[model samples]
Target: MERDLSRQELTAETLVLWEKTRMSLRNCIKRVMRSHGVEDHKVWGTVHAYAFEIVKLLGTIDALIDHVTKGSSTREMHPWVRNPLRVATYEMKWRDLKPAIATSEAVRIISERVGDGPARFANAVLYDVEEVTLEEVLEKAEDEIERLSIEYSHPTWYVKHLLDLLGRDELIELMKANNEEPVRYLRVNAHLKDPDAVILALEREGVVVEEDPHVPLILRVVEWNVPPVRTEPYRRGWVTYQDKASAAAAYALAPEPGERVLDACSAPGNKAAYVYAYTCGEVELTCVDINPRRIEEMKRNFKRWGVEAEVVRADAARLKGVLNGGFDAALVDPPCSSSGSYNRTPEAKWTVKWRHVRRYAEGQLRILRGVADLKPGRMVYSTCSVTVPENEDVVHRFLSHEDTYSTRKPDVPVGSPGFDRWMDRRYRHHRHMIRLWPHRHMTEGFCVTLLEGG
Candidate 1:
């Protein structure tokens, strides 16, 4: 009983931190665990699962709380009271925990942490939440967008945005896919180990995987008795986890051996490492990123994969005097709204807004213009986003200003063409851009466009 109470308290505290800091949920969990000196993997796993599940359904959960409280918003409540109530409501509704037990645990935690008044309030809220069903709250939605948002736990604005782009049936499919468990893929490091040998090693460790059809050396994880990271093959760096669509971006770049390749806005450099592995360490790689911590992480990753590259710490948007112009190929993978990655990073669904998407498109255009000045023979701009503004519009805006470069159809075979509608007229080279959908591709939504210098 005490163990269960501790878990609830820990999860509530983690949620409070996430709300306060607005950092990634995983990072917030790490901070809470470290502060409590909690190192048990079992506890970590339990807390992680609970926190992520609650956060993934935040919109729905908050709506339920608001409905029960009768016009009171969860945002107005104290974190101590609010988060504990959220944790309890999730347990009751989603985890199928006995309402009495879930409410009792939440009230106990709130009473111990805040005081009796808040605890009493939380108990009343949970009691009310217990009587209501999610379907009841969803039925109150004023429109289809709001209903879909509540049902799938996405922001209402984002649902409407997707509906505008994909229409009704496709938008619902995407929302359903976003709420499901994300698929994991492994890319065998063919530079260090033979693909067959890596597969044999993974199977020996009780990991079931199958080859991805379109992308060479990529495998879909079927089942695993042991975590892949703890397995021998992963320990030896023979295989690393990467989405098949992400790996496709590197293939689109297709840097040849002995050519100078620039990876802009690249840190935690998975794609750059893939390029090195693709060329068997023969490509001259230079990676640029602004974050020091991610740069260190990328360095560690490079060492593990036997990859060699020059790391530069600077903004990709303003690279003059920091880098030279001569390069055979370059990859411009700037950060964006990350809408396509909501399944894996559900926190982003709440954090990113339409305004942020417009800002991202602006920033993406700047990075493209900056990188284009360097005159790489070929460049691929990619983002883990499904929005038109960040993909096709950014490319269109860049090409409008920069006449020296032209769009080329990405060599990769998978994914659909970019949307052609721009201001009621067709974008000139919309077919040159490729979009991978989570519903269709079983991968994170991604957009890739290839550009060539004359």
Candidate 2:
């Protein structure tokens, strides 16, 4: 009977720890992935499972530490104590739970798991931890690494990398943004409604949407929990749920009716649907992705939009064996570090590390090399990553190394220019790459580079 009561409280505390600890494990997994080149879909299931174990273990340890530290008042200890103490403090401060309840839950979870001594230690420290403010605790932190870790609840290295990319102010905004639930964006499926008409339709339906100047047909939904997609307009394929930035790729491709299009790495067929719709179903589209599971999902989406395309599960880098060189256009939305889309999938930021970004860049280069072989005069090579190494830099390296490929600007509404020096160095004759960001354009990060064949 007593065990059941204790278990219930531990469970409540575990829920709080679960969210915090899962975030930690996600950061760790991303760090290790680049060394090994693992994808998120493969690791996310493990992350979900490991989150429970991590919280349970951390809660147990905090309890144990408190047991050892008893008799000491909260004022005596340094604000930054053990990991579990820090975690418990997060629960009390940020989570809005009763401090005593938070402390007891940590103690219960620890004592039940680790026997008496460790549990006593965790209990004692947690009792002393209730008074410490997150800001005060961070001030007591010895270094930037420790400070950012406690302050943002992120791994130290990840915070440093963000600081390197975005500097101090922007990085803080990015981190705070990631911690919140993301806004959902939609791409007006052009097959159903032209961009202007779609906006009017959404407004008429009481769905507030703002145009993304950087992206062609992307719309940002101001109010969440409103399932605008379920509305008659959306049900009739007027708009598709996609990041505004992501929609830029297919729109840049700008397929014309009766054109032959190849979409490499196109599973979960948002782009394929966009291709068929944007071209008004005039183009013959061939879509492919390596994962069969994603292919099935793409098929479902394709069906939903009432667009027909030849879908295959195959590697884009090895498509020479299967697809001929007759394709007039191709879209390579290959695997990437979802740096730009992190706003939509906050869980993604947790999974990104410096190494994974490099691996994605290398893999994208190989995919681009394969794309060059198709002899496409116009192709879109895009990623949902805002990282220079993955977007402009990847295109630069590809053009520098691949003798047959060049660059061009498409006919669509122009967005941001490509990186200044990189373009001058690689394609001085033409600069047609487009960069999109959430902060500027109110969408996820996306880049679309137009390539002209040799």
lDDT of 1 at 301: 91
| Count of clashing pairs, candidate 1 | 0
User: Which one wins on lDDT?
Assistant: 1
**Cα-based TM-score, every candidate:** 0.97, 0.72
Prediction 1 TM-score vs. true: 0.97
Model 1 C-alpha RMSD to native: 1.8
The best candidate by TM-score is 1
In candidate 1, list every pair of residues with a backbone clash. none
lDDT of the structure predicted as candidate 1 = 0.89
Q: List model 2 lDDT by residue over 1-454, tens digit each.
A: 2222222232333334434465434444444344344455435344433333333233223333333355553234332223345445556654666888877766655565555665577676666566544455556567876565545554455567556656777766655554444567787777767878887877777888887665666788876334686577688777878865567778887787888999999978888777787677788989989998788888888877788889877788888877877888889889997777654544455456878888999999999888677787678998987777788778878877787777777655745666554323543522678776565555566788888773
- Candidates' C-alpha lDDT: 0.89, 0.66
lDDT per residue (tens digit) for residues 288-390 in model 1: 9999999999999988888889999998988878997788999999989999998888999888889999999999989888888788898999999988888
Question: Candidate 1: deviation at residue 169, Å?
Answer: 1.5
